[model samples]
Target: MTELVALVPAHDEQDGIVATLAGLYRQSLRPDRIVVVADNCADLTAEIAERCGAEVFVTSGNRDKKAGALNQAVPAVLDTLPDDALLLVQDADTVLNPGFVRCAVDALDEDEGVGAVGGIFFGEEGGGLLGLLQRMEYERYALEIHRKGNEAVVLTGTGTVFRARVLREVRAARRAGRIGGGDGYYSLASLTEDDEITKAVKTLGHRTVSPDGCWLVTEVMPTLPKLWHQRMRWQRGALENLRDYGLTRVTLPYFGQQIMLGLGAVALGLFAVFTVIVLVTVGWQGFSLFWTAITLIFVLERTLTVRGAGRRAVLLALPLVPELLYDVFRQLVFARSLVDLVLRRQEHWVAT
Candidate 1:
C-alpha cells in the first residue's frame, strides 16, 4: 500500500486552527502523517496542532510566507516518509470530508498519469447573504473547472493531493540538467507553487483534476470587504502565476476567457452609465425596463449555478447577485492585488 502525508501551513490561526485540526483528526481515512508548519506565528498554533495529533514544525523566520514554509517543510517530511508517498498541501483553516484523504490517494494510485487532484469546498453550512454569495462564487468556479475538462489548469492549493514520487522526479530531472537546458532552471518557482507544479506535471505529459465526489467545507468571509480582499488576492496570484509562465503560452487558449470576462465587465459598466443617461433623457420606464432585463439575466445565471447547493444559497445570493456581478468590489480587489504584487507588499501570514 502507498503512504500518504498531509502538510498544512499555518500562522496566527489560533481561533480557527483548532477546529480545522479536529476535522483532520476525524477523517474516516486518516493520513499516515499530518504535519503543520507554524510559520513565525506568535499564537498557539503549534500547541493546537500537537493536541490534534499533527506533528508541529515551528519556523523561526518566514520571509517568503507560504511558499517558503512549504519549501522548508517538504524536505523534513520526506525524511520521514517513503519515496512513493503522497503529500497533500492545504490551508490551516480548511476542513475536509471524512473520505478526503482516502479518495484522493486512491485516485492518484489508480492512475499513473494523474499527478494532482483537489476537491470541492462549500462555505460554512449557513450564514446570511454574505455567506451565500461566497458559496455561489466558489460553486461557480468549481463548475467551470469541471466543465473545462482535464486539458485546463484549474487546480486549487487549498486542498490538493500530489504524488511525492512525481515531485521527486521533477526535482531529480531539474538537478540532472534534463529540463530547461541551463543552470538557472526552476523545478518550481511560480508565485503559486501549486500552479507551477501542476503545469510542470502537465508539461511532462501528466494530468491534474478536481473530482466531483470528494468534498470539503470551509468558512466564507463574514463581510463584503473581507470577501473582496480574499478574491483580489486569489485573482492577482493567478494572473501573476500566469504571467510568470509567459503570457504568450496562455494567449491562445485563455484569451477567450480573458476577453469575454473583460468585455462583460465593460458591458455592465456601460449599462450602469446608460441607465442613468436614459433616466435623464427619457423617463423612469426606460430605466426600469433596462434594470429588469439585467436583473432577469442575473437571476437566470444564479439559478443555473445553484441547483445542487440548496435553497438558502439561491435566495441569499439571489438578492446580492446583482451587486456581486455589477459592483466594483472584485474589480477593486483585482486592481489592489496588482499593486500589492508590484510594490512587493509586505504581507504577513494570516489564516484564510
Candidate 2:
C-alpha cells in the first residue's frame, strides 16, 4: 500500500481552488496529503485553498511560471514524504473523477517499468459553441490516447501520477547538472514541462502510461482567440522539447508524424488556393473530379472519426462546415508554430 501525496499548482485560481480540493477529498482512494502551491498569487487563492483543507505554500519572486513554482514547492514537499509514496500533480482548474487516482495507481503498480501515468481528460459539462467544439476535440484526443495503449508519448499536465523515487531521481539529476539546471523535477527551458519530464522518464528506461479508466474533467478555453493562444503555446513548446532532446529512435516517429501533419496542411492550403484561382478563371467547370473526390473523402473521414464524441458531435460534424473550418484553423496554428520555432521566436506562458 503506497501512500499518495497530491500537489496542485495554482496561480490566482481563487474561484476554482475550492472545487479542485473538493474533488480530491471525494476521491475513492484519497491522498494521504494534499498541498497547494500558490505561485505569485495576487488573489485570495492561498486563502481559499487553506479554507478548503489544503496545506498551502506561498511562493515569492518565482518568475519561471508554473515550472519554477513547482521547483520551489516539490523539494519541500518531498522532504516530508515517505520512500514508498507517489506524487500526483494536477492543475488547479481541473477536477478528477472519484476513481481517477485509484485506477492510475493500479496502472503504475501493475508494471515496475512504468514511471508515470496520466488521465484521459474531457471538457467540463456546459458551455457555448466554443466549448462544444473543445468537447469534440477532447473526445477525439482521448480516443487517440486510448488507441496508443500504454506507450503514451506525453504525460499531460492536466493530471499525472509519478513514482516518488523516479521524481527524486529526476531532481537529483537536475541538481547535478546532468540534465537541465533546475532545483526541482520540472524543467524551465521548455513551455511544456510535462512533455520534457516525459522525455526524461523515458531516457531513464521507464515508460509512461495513460489508463483509459482514469478520467479527468477540465475547463476549456471559452473563445477561439483564447484557444488559439493556448494551442500556439502547446505547439511551440512541443517543438522546443524536441529540439532540446534531439532526435532519438523513440522520438523519431513522433517527429515524423508532426512533419507529415504540417506537410498535409501545406497541401491543403495549396489546393484551396488553386481552387480559388480556377473558380475565378474558368467558372465551376474548371473544377477537377479528382480534387472534389479528395475533399469529400477527407470530410467523410473527419466526420466518421468524430462520431465517438456523441450524438451532438455527430450532428455538428454532419454538415462538415464547422469541423472543416476548425481543421483549417488548427492547421494555420500549426503552420504559425512551425514558423515561430524556425525563427527562434520567444514564447511566454499565457494563463487562460
**Which of the numbered candidates is closest to the native, going by highest TM-score?**
2
lDDT of 2 by residue, 208-273 (tens): 888887888999888888899989888888888788777886568669978987888989889899
What overall lDDT, based on C-alpha atoms, would model 1 receive against the true structure? 0.69
Candidate 1 TM-score to native: 0.82
| TM-score of every model versus the real structure | 0.82, 0.93
**What ranges in model 2 sit over 4 Å off?**
181-183, 286-300
| lDDT of prediction 2 | 0.85
Which whole-number lDDT from 0 to 100 does residue 36 have in model 1?
89
Models, CA RMSD each: 3.9, 2.1
Q: What is the C-alpha lDDT profile of model 1 across 1-352, one tens digit per residue?
A: 7787888889788787877777777887777788888999888888877887889987766576676777678778876767678888888778888787777877777888787787777777665766766677777776877687633355566688877766666666656754431122122344455555555556565677777656677778887666665675556655655555555443335445545555666776788899799889987763467878998897878777876677766765567545466346666555566577788775333334
RMSD of 1: 3.9
Best model number under lDDT:
2
lDDT of each: 0.69, 0.85
